[model samples]
Target: MKEGSRLLDEMNDRSREVFRRVVEAYIESGEPVGSRTLTRTLSEKVSAATIRNVMQDLEFLGLLDSPHVSAGRIPTQLGLRMFVDGLLEVRDLDHHDREKLDATLGAGAGDVGGLLDRVGAALSGVTHGASLVLTPKHEAPMKHIEFVSLGHDRALVVLVFADGHVENRLFAPPPGQTPSSMREAANFLNAMIEGKTLSELRRDMAREIAARRQELNSLAAEMIETGMAMWEGEADNSARLIVRGRANLLGGEAEAEELDRIRTLFDDLERKRDIAEFLQLAETGEGVRIFIGSENKLFSLSGSSLVVSPYMNADRKIIGAVGVIGPTRLNYGRIVPIVDYTAQLVGKLIAERSER
Candidate 1:
């Protein structure tokens, strides 16, 4: 083999042992490790000096880091990435794990919203970390729209789209509006805005109303604006985020100061748009994606890790992603395959649902 390939092969074999030790030490103590610990604990018969030399080589290759002089080495983000990609070994979920997940996720058949929440909760519970599920944005083309008037200047806007998706948005009308005006606005939209995307509808309505302002009554125009504005906000906040088990991060393994930091992290997650955008990056890729340490800007401050896998629809279109976020010392060998398999399970379930 060529020198590069030979080096790669050697590194592959050697790093497996190194990565195993690094992961175990990190998990047990949540601290960086030195060669002495590995030399003492590793089953291999290497001397401490020899282990130190190998660790230096690993560090030179960017997989290990020495946080302090004379202290043990820790797996850097790049090291974690390599371990996940090349060294990690994972097994299928055991029967108990499968049973737990199935019971939690399979509880609400045919209810996509409830199923998503349950999946998030189950993932978080199993991982003992915060879990996130990104739901598919409504991509179906608009088939029809209708507005129903309610009392107190409020109206319900029902949107029917081509893919059998229906959503209702309640719009509060402008002050002093009546049922007659609301009906007029709805009729105008039904006649003019069928088969339009939400953006198209908004733009066309603005242009048409601007041109015909002189011919229309003020109440009708105001009602139209109200209805358009209602769904517009919904479109902007399109991506749905389901998060569960954030409180699980509070106690175990994390220090008191770390808990405070995690509380802020949970607060940030409550702002769904941020987490949605973060998962959006993961949904663009195939297979499992690992964000280690500073690799992901959002969780860099917390020194966290995220493993995500994109879920797809029947047409092979990526619709969403599911993942777990935890401290960087997480077991990549174990969690990577778990997240990936769960994503496949989710995709299969969604496909089955679409068929039904």
Candidate 2:
């Protein structure tokens, strides 16, 4: 049997009942649950002394903890994991939420950008936490490319992909470049952008430069090489990340003591790298993944939780991930299926668009 199941079995009936009550109480109130609270909540009317003894036993087993010397007991991260794995009674996705997602996300496949926006917003609203969506590794073919000078030796590369997604990338021009040379470089790249991904475009550029370096002027060659190298390295290597519903974290019954943690959370959110790191924990997994506090180091400062699931294409290959970031006290049973169902919808919509 699994370790979690075996741990559950090791507990006598009374201890198990008290442990479940404490976990549920923590979920409901985000506070340490004391023996008196469990005494009032549990259906079997166990005495406070008996419940206290059981709590100490659970603490000894590494399942429960006390924040202060005198504080009530709360489920430790390991305890949460055991409760989730062994006792979490996950039900099917709610019919109302399913209909809401279908109505909101069923269409708009042509514009992947707008579709992602709706997805982030819907997840944020339904789960009452921040939602994160990582765009797939840019498989769409390049349809067009433009170089616009930003007037500080910097230029923006406007890329239009065949999947109707547009993105902008920036690169610093090598010293002593001209607009005409920029135009020449763009013209060269445009010729090869058709039906080719960024990776393909890089290969084509490398070949062209090697075989015909003399065919192009010195400045244009530098621009072409520099721009292509930057684009391929930056765009292809990093998946675009979308985050929404940050304000929800600050809303509702936020205790004053939690303000510092919330501030830290906002800092983590502002750094896209941290959010990406949280989702990175899910990239290798199969289905819904749960990373509680300390499990996600980047968010551990804020005591946050990450629940993500990989969205797949029709080929059953993982295209991207979608999920929420909330306090560690998230309603795991409810939010887990919400994220799973959202990922399925996202994958289905992408697949439908691909069939066209």
Candidate 3:
């Protein structure tokens, strides 16, 4: 048996039953589970004293905790992790949810970015929590490249991908570059770099440029060099992070004291790097990745949990992720399958598009 299963096996029947009830109650109310409530909630004939003793014993085992000196007990992050891994029953999406997700994702057939935005919105609406979608930075080869003059040494670099996606970025051009020079640069790049990925172009650019240097004037050559330099070592931001339903983090049955934690989470969200790093870790694994409260350093201060699942491409390689972020009490059994299905749907859509 695995470690989680072994741990479950070690618990006595009463301990296991009481622990499960406490977790279930906590998940439902987002509050600590008191002995009086457990007496009424549990099917067993155990007295309140007996249930309280069980709660303490479970606490000693690091499964439950008390939020206050005289308050009820709540399941710790460790307890929740074990409960999800060992005891939870994940169910399939119902007919209604299936249709909803299908309609939402199908709306964007060939537009990958727009599809991912819908994925994020769908997840957030379903789970009543913030949703995140991390899409692959490079999905298709370039169909065309152009540099348009925007003045003040700033130029607009427009990239048209074979997938029919157009992305434009404002970049600083080399000094002394003109509209004519930029057009020359665009013509030079489009002639050689079309139909190739950024990675492929990076590999052959130096050799290609060196061989053709004599044919290109000094201004055009400098513009080309500067444009290439702008993209180096910084394009990884292409792994886009789309977040929705942030307001869902507030309201509901949340306690007054919990507001501080929510505030902290709001501040944390401002740091995209932190959210990006968390999702990157999810990409390393298959299926759904669950980080319960303190298990993830990013949300520890806010006592939040994240359910992330990586989406793949036609080749069965992981390409991106879609996930939900909410309070620790968010429904895992329901959200897990929803996230998994969404990831699979995204991968399927991408695969179908690639085949064409």
Candidate 4:
């Protein structure tokens, strides 16, 4: 009869305890929990008949449901939401989990790109769900540079950053350009970018090239200038996304309808538009956030849940997010702390990188 949050407040203490026990048991086994089962689990000395009466009252309140007349009851989506928003007891992240995250993410701290992949892997491992890691734009010192010819006067500039990020930029070659000249230009520009970022090179590029004009022919110089000019101006603000452990979403105990929902969820994951929307969810508001089933607009039909926390930089600006994706029936009490701790570690990593 009462609304979600208020229902907990209005519920009699015995009724509330019985409802909580039912939701916990159902979440543990994904089965309808009988009042007899609650009688065993509840610390209070309650009789099975009394618990059954409470369950009936709960079902009447729209917080619980029974699949059959004599079978046990399960919490509805609204019921689960109410529990998560109120009754769930989330623990602090344990020391072992903190160390594991450090070891996993810090495997190769210098390789920021590889670290992003590991972040996804660690999140999936910890939360038992598909992980979506949204990485910020790649802007780091140059590690290596190469120019590959794509024919038809088109060439590809493959850039390897010091922080393990690799990017490809396309450019058209100038007239009279040959393989030898392109190689010569690559060697010359590579030397100029050893400790400099793309932005720095763009700023002092003309002067640097003018000084080395005698080393390269007119055509090679023109080619190098054209290639470098393409990378000038602001770096692309587009976030690079990493998706891992999608297979983990499969092979769970599910009915035909639930199986269909999982398939629909996979289909949504493969869609660019849906993925973009999912990423936007991580950027919404702050702290650790949870979206259960239909509350998540992108995968509403799939009946999926997302537990995410945004990681920020030294400036407290949210740089990215680390989170998990799974079915609606997940262990929120356990996963919340893991996600929150991981996000904090990621934020610290971002801060460390900025200082370097």
Candidate 5:
């Protein structure tokens, strides 16, 4: 297929008008749009035959396709891309949309996890499509570390971040360890491991303990290693996947085989690891990324569409992503701006949370 940018440039005034009308009609009705409908609705002074000829040219350009020989042409993936990139005029969030978004964002504070869950649910409700929110990767520098004795051989290691985020990990103390040893180990780590990444602290602590065998008691060194191991495990499991509105996919008209494929897609999404990988790709991208049919291997069977945008922190570093997934017939002109706006809103919320 030709690049959407080149195809958009090649379209003349009359052809562009016909193409826009057909794309708009198809998006609204989710059906093939005939030239007659364009003639009736468009304000342009053009006959049905003229519109038909232009649509034929657009079909040759791979922007339009006819599902049936007798039916009119509908916008293809390329057509949607061209319209979204060149023709679609994104409007400001309307009063209703702004009010709904504000209400959703205002419902919670302090708990980032709860705020993200509500954001995903609100997005799904507004878009009528599946919504996804990938949790921010923890990159805060360590401020302090402490190991508190909980019970028999099990201790709770509290990690305080420079951003005021505190996470606790439960760990079993190494063999032949006591609460006094654990306390000593905690003091040693708090003195040496402050303002370092978990990985950095782990590597440095390992080297120090290995080099100085006789400098400290064996039990104290073992307790320190145990606490470091717990922090590493928690960091590995920190990224979360939030998905909502799987039921909305079933409401559309699709063949049984297609429905089965969609079910499989949902199953794949349920695996948090895979979803995290997918969202990670978008998180590193420059801006909103659109994946059309057959563009990604995961959704090839379902021929689904994904519109994603990364949400950033106060420093403009991408911390997460928010997006919608639906069938190829999704309204890109409408949904693209919605996703973009929502991403910005998510970024703002994250920045505020980080400041706190």
Candidate 6:
């Protein structure tokens, strides 16, 4: 499809009015809009014949589509993109919306993950669609690491991230490793890599081990490698895509024919790794980003829409993102501002917690 930038300014005033009305009607009722319906819904009285001609012109220009031979027209994904980028006017959140967001997110949660989960759940409840929150990873440097024997060659690596996010991983000791060796390993790592990001620590450890393999104690090096590997793996997995409210899509007012499409979307959501990487694109921009159906690689096959906005830290750095996913006929004007506001609230909450 042609980018909205090329086609948005090419439409005549009459075509633009008819297209806008058709899209608005479709978004409200989730149904195709005929010329007669457009005539009744539009503020200005336009003849049905004129609307039909305008719609035909829009269809020809790839802005609209008729799903059935006798059915009314609906805005194509391209059309929705154009409307969102060029024609859409975002409304301010109502009092109820503001209050709901404040009540849900304004309170200080104990940790970053809890706050992020609440934000995802609230967005899902508000938009009635699947919500996703890509959480910030390793928000603070490591304060401590410990290991306890679970017996029978198993041990637990306990992590205390500086921000108070604690995690535990099960590990197997390399032949005859004891609790003393484990403590020694933890102490050595703490002294060597304290105040460094997990990523940085991992890189430094790899270089140190390579350069001084013989100088380093064999048991200490082995323990550090095992512990660091677990930490790295957990960090990568924990700060991944958090998807909620998948059932919301199926339980909505969609028709039976749309079941296959929803199932396809469910399968797509199951690809969490891909979704997490795809969401990173949102962090490149400053404000809300809307990906209409087919416009995004992840949602293209599912024929869905995504509205995402990045959340920032106190340093004004974009750390993660929150968004809603649903069918293309979503209420753009309403959902756009809601997602935008939720993102801002999440950023504010994270920043406040960081200061604490």
Residue-level lDDT of model 6, residues 254-298, one tens digit each, is 787676777887686664436545546686778988888777877
The per-residue C-alpha lDDT of model 4 at residue 355 equals 92
**lDDT, candidate 5, at 44:** 78
TM-score of each model, paired residue for residue: 0.71, 0.77, 0.76, 0.71, 0.72, 0.78
92 Cα displacement, candidate 3 (Å) = 2.5
Q: What is the C-alpha lDDT profile of model 1 across 47-114, one tens digit per residue? A: 88888888888878776788799888887777676666655667766667677777877776767677
Per-model CA lDDT versus the true structure: 0.74, 0.82, 0.81, 0.79, 0.78, 0.80
**How many clashing pairs per prediction, in order?**
3, 0, 0, 0, 0, 0
Residue 55 Cα positional deviation in candidate 3, in Å, after optimal superposition: 0.8
lDDT of 2 by residue, 1-356 (tens): 76667889889888888888889889989888888887877878878998899899999988999998868999988888889888888879998888888888875555666787899989998888898887777777989888888875898888889989888877788888888888988888898789998778888889999998998889999988888656544443346677899889887878876767877876765654354454456667778988888877767787778889999888988867898988877899899999999998898888877788
What residue runs in model 1 are displaced by over 4 Å at the alpha carbon? 1-16, 60-62, 68-71, 140-192, 197-237
- Model 3 alpha-carbon drift over 4 Å, by segment: 1-6, 108-110, 139-196, 200-237, 275-279
Residue-level lDDT of model 4, residues 1-356, one tens digit each, is 43688889998889889989888888789889997888778889988998888999999989999998889999988899999988999987877777878889888766556777889999888776888787765557877878887885788888888988788866677777778788887887777788877767656668877787886788778887877655541222235567788778876667888778877877766553454455567677788999889988867889988888888889888767778888777888888988998888888887888798
TM-score of 6: 0.78
Per-residue lDDT over 135-202 for candidate 5, one digit per residue giving the tens place of the 0 to 100 score: 77666778887778877767787888888988876667776778788787877777777778766777
Give the candidate number with the greatest lDDT.
2
lDDT of 4 at 162: 90
Candidate 6: the clashing residue pairs are: none
> What lDDT does candidate 2 reach at residue 16?
85
Candidate 3's displacement at residue 238, Å, is: 1.4
Model 4 TM-score is 0.71
